[model samples]
Target: MASILMLTAATRRERNDATSFVFDAINACGGWIEDVHMYSNKMTTVRLALPGTAIEDLIGSLIDGGIAVDPPEAPASSDDRERRVTLQLTFLHDEPDLMRDIPAIPG
Candidate 1:
């Protein structure tokens, strides 16, 4: 089974570390990124889809690269059937824990 870890960079600010926006390295690590703009915030959203059930190495890599994570966004309706295991996330960017946990329910 494949699992996705998504990290949202809250603002336009960036860091000067080894993990500082290296697109090639991220792609090499089996990750893809989408840039989002919300009002004044230019967020860099990264999605890492890991192969198989093992997620430790990927999580470790994200942590090493200064990327923070949150629990998988919850599904709407009681019938949604995705099993999610939450990794310990770094709260550096401060997740919008209240609103973000709930995935949008399509009408």
Candidate 2:
């Protein structure tokens, strides 16, 4: 099983329950609560590690919850066979498992 990385947050301060609840759910689903790194702007980022989990599956669920994913940009290539795909992700809510803290928020 490959190590799956993910980001989870309530996004709204009013939804503390939502965030806490989601964290609990993740733990129940065999997710490891790694670390939480809050931004200076007050955006709290939590990190969780899950063993034997698929990042795609977690990403799908986040999508279902209105999550947005912003994947890394593809590097430029001169080869004809070389191609790059960019994926951006976001979330309407945190997943049951696989919450990760993003110290440096992606642009």
lDDT of each: 0.37, 0.41
Give the winner by lDDT.
Answer: 2
The residue-by-residue lDDT of candidate 2 on 59-82, one tens digit each, is: 444444444444323222322331
**Cα lDDT tens digits for candidate 1, 68-89:** 5343353212322332332222
Residue 17 error for model 2, in Å? Answer: 5.1
TM-score of each model, in listed order: 0.34, 0.41
Query: Residue 94: error of model 2 in Å?
Result: 20
- Kindly report which residue pairs in candidate 1 clash with one another: none
On the 0 to 100 scale, the lDDT of residue 64 in model 1 is 55
